[model samples]
Target: MAPYASDDSTTGGEVDEQRSGRRKAARYVVPVTVMGVAAATIGLVPALADSGDPDLPKITAQQLIEKIATSDVQQLSGTVKISTDLGLPDLGGLESSLMSGAAGRGEGGSSADPTAKLTELASGTHTLRVAADGPDKQKLSLLENAAEYSLVHNGKDVWGYDSKSNEVFHGTASESPKHEKGKEQQPPATPKDFAEEALKAADDTTSVTVDGTAQVAGRDAYKLLIKPKQSGTTVGAITVAVDSETGMPLKFTLTPASGGAAVVDAGFTQVSFAKPAASTFDFTPPKGAKVTEEKDAGKGAEKGFGKGFHKGFDKGEARKHAPKSEEGLGKGLGGMKTIGEGWNSIATFDTGGEGVPSGKGGGDLGGFVDSLGDKVTGKFGSGTVFSTRLVNALITDDGKVYVGMVTKDALVKAADAGK
Candidate 1:
């Protein structure tokens, strides 16, 4: 998305407002990009084998896919464990930037690091408590040491509460134009979310098969494996553990193309098919606690962490205050588009070189960009390619970004093609 507001003709007050709005939007560039890489890393890791294999009726891959599609599961509660090993360099100041930006924007009352908590999902292991009764009432609690961050979606309200800061992020689905009148919100906090996305590659881009029977969360499950047919993608194979009884995906594992340790392994450690309590969806800000209303909270629920979770902070604020650009460069998520299909697809956008916030809170955007990846030139011009085990993000010198679970060369190629 266009990172900031730019106009050739405007008054001093308009210029000041534009600068302020741009700064807020630019702050999201790093944290969101890093989290997006992490999400892709999670989507490309290896599977965890059960201690014992379970003997169940054999099902074909197509049957398993159908089963998952026809799953009648309307309510459930579970504890999910997500672990990632992207082999990333030490974040250094970026960690502080993430925490600082989160604190600075969300009502400016929180000292706690909610953004750090979310980015942690990209590095180490995390546990989440998820409960959903149909789609309208769902809750995800990110359990931390002596702290918890929750995102709850009730009938009309969506609440994100961070216990460490005692901060409440409030939003209403009815208030967001993006939300449909009778639709349900889907949070990216579930194994099913990862599985469904993986299944989309079951077409010509990948080979799908039922590898075997396995046990997950103390229940028997069918193992559905999807392997990319093309060599350009970094993903090796995506293995999903689909519950035998109810067709729910209990676990998702992604292995890198290079093949060694699994970069991501997320699954349910405990799960119940029974409906969750109604009170689980109800939330109220505590007395004297800070509350921030998010008008566009519904915008990013469908995207990965890189694009979705960060919307809670600046998207609505920037859009409301910033002047509308007919070119759509200032429209953050709206400015993004994907090229290609399936595994090699690249998400592209323009940032207009908006200065990103520093880890010390603000300043030195170029230094932050330099710290991320090496400078390289190609047919698409010079850019930075942030490489990990499974994903590479190319930030072009002209303020364009191309990201995918593909090699650096592939990213450059995509940029050149777009040009």
Candidate 2:
């Protein structure tokens, strides 16, 4: 099936399906590319497993933090395994919409996109190896069903290929390497960020410390741990595995205060700090593979992708305005206010009515959050609590919504104040 078949008569179902596919693909680049770009500055050291247990260099928490901030070992190749246990509901339908494209959505919808399948494996201990020669050249391959879903970006071209479907999407972009020495970056807060974030703490509200050395992917790593000292926070602690040699982040984990286990755990399962073969950076799609040229994709890289119907959403911007009225929430749950601070911060948005709008229910009961979370009501009245590894949200039956990285107690208090 063709990947992009533009049609003006598209139904809402087809739109949702296409949108779901785009959202899934966009999420892949955020975490993976964010991690790679940091290390790709020096070399790509994906991960190393069960390596020589060399003793980590003796350094104070402050000194270790400094080294992690300055070191750059960008040119390397290794496999990274990303795993998540966010407790999200099964997103099979969402995945189907993505994989089957317009055809799965409604009648006359004919596009078939492999991007849906890409995200389906992004979670759940999925592993892929990365190789880069310089800032302008990088290649990543995701393994699925033993078939390969690969993305190769040389200085000239960026290619996305799905072996299972024998489809290739190619686009050209002028790759420019950012060369800013000692410039700190905070993707998701690396080891050095522990110290940096601590510097902003208000009166012992946050603590940063290195919890000795351990082996990650067989390489020596210092565990930089951050904890919230405030009683209002529901955070357990954030632990980061910093490679001793390259100062690159190898793994990151976040545990909830109500945790029995980690809610968010992402890291490299294997890695190597060695230059990959030159041939590894080269790519040629299998013969007879249907190729789509993106020369007329658009003026910008994103515009090009959009022309091919691979639209991307701005996750960061979306988060800032999530509770707003994009979902026809005109008079309810539009503006969310912040309360507390740091790991203890809570966001509360009031529906300003009796309950959630359920079309015919008229906010009597049930929820708009049901599609987003599990139904759980308590002293704050009936509501649904949508939770992930890091964030938990509570939507009350009284048109009140509370969310935070803090505890359920903090959420409840925020809900009470909204009343």
Candidate 3:
């Protein structure tokens, strides 16, 4: 049930600086984190059990919110299962297309098909084993069929291993080199992390309630229900199951506005609050495996699973084909900005033609993006609007990208307003 560090251990000037930094970081990171997780889990659907609601003392919404906000559990290990059903087309076709392109290039590196790896994650139920001893030591392992992919954070070093590819990625990052633990390192993909992000949206636009108690991971828990009061947002509500004894979040679920079932549901099947073994964070790449090293791994280590793989594995290969405009755009996420606030907030960015395949060797990815959504034309100009059960993304012909959990009409309006 324990995940992510929200330490309020500073005083005076340091406190003010840390708070300011957190606000700025959240503004940029949370939106992309939400959108990226949703996009990746297009077909994932978790299988959660119903053991009946447990009887417990009543608690208010604000109380539950505060409980989660101030949870200080430092160490734990757990198994998380994630399932999402976004009602989008299967990405298997695109995976094949990208893999074919990779093979054609005669690339046999350890991280050959980064896009393909993400597509594979989209289709199935994903089980992750996560352990965290403290802020500086943590581990996340994606349990695949007979194979495991792991990322370990031990002291100043981060290690990633792909068992199937037999490839290892190592990066060195110092914990708050300048600020003395003032910065919050990016947490691994987990329900607790997602719950904390969702909690930030519980402002004037959201209605939060404590909807009784339930048993999660064999522990008695309280259910925190958060609903958006505004329209145009695809998110109907987010349910977070928090442990009763400890304030830690055990599960997080997001349902669509036009709801049938939850679009994304992630929860622990097994959890232990005890500190994980010291050796858990210690890792060594296999003898015959190819190894890639990054001197500054702080940024790359933040991305979860497949994205982290691409950032580390294809770091060299990508630079060759990357456009100069993209090189500049990469500095600040291509002028990315949010147009609104809370549930209906829209994130707009300049793609610099990153999504469109340009060269002769490029495969059917252009066709793939073109196939997903209808061609839309408006005051903002012509573009393609791609949608899933919970998100809508508009890619303009002029290389602008607009994404939100709102309807296509709302997204277009936002785009027009921006233009």
Best candidate per TM-score, number?
3
Which regions in candidate 2 have their CA more than 4 angstroms from the true location? 1-54, 91-122, 171-204, 232-234, 284-339, 346-383, 395-403, 415-419
Ranking of candidates on lDDT, top first:
1, 3, 2
Per-residue CA lDDT of candidate 2, range 251-308, in tens? 7776767776765465666777687787876778789887755443323222122111
Deviation of model 3 at 137, angstroms: 1.4
**Which residue pairs collide, candidate 1?**
2-329, 44-254, 45-254, 45-255, 46-254, 46-255
Tens digits of per-residue lDDT for model 1 on 391-417? 777887777877677888888889888
* TM-score for each candidate, following the candidate numbering: 0.73, 0.60, 0.73
Worst 10 residues of 1 by lDDT: 317-326
Per-model lDDT:
0.67, 0.54, 0.67
Tens digit of lDDT per residue, candidate 3, span 235-340?
Answer: 8888999998888889988898897987778899999989899999888877988776653322223223323433322221221111111321243254767788
Off-target runs (Cα >4 Å) in candidate 3 are 1-51, 93-109, 112-123, 175-187, 295-332, 354-364
Clashes found in each candidate (C-alpha, N, C closer than 3 A): 6, 17, 5
lDDT of 2 at 175: 24
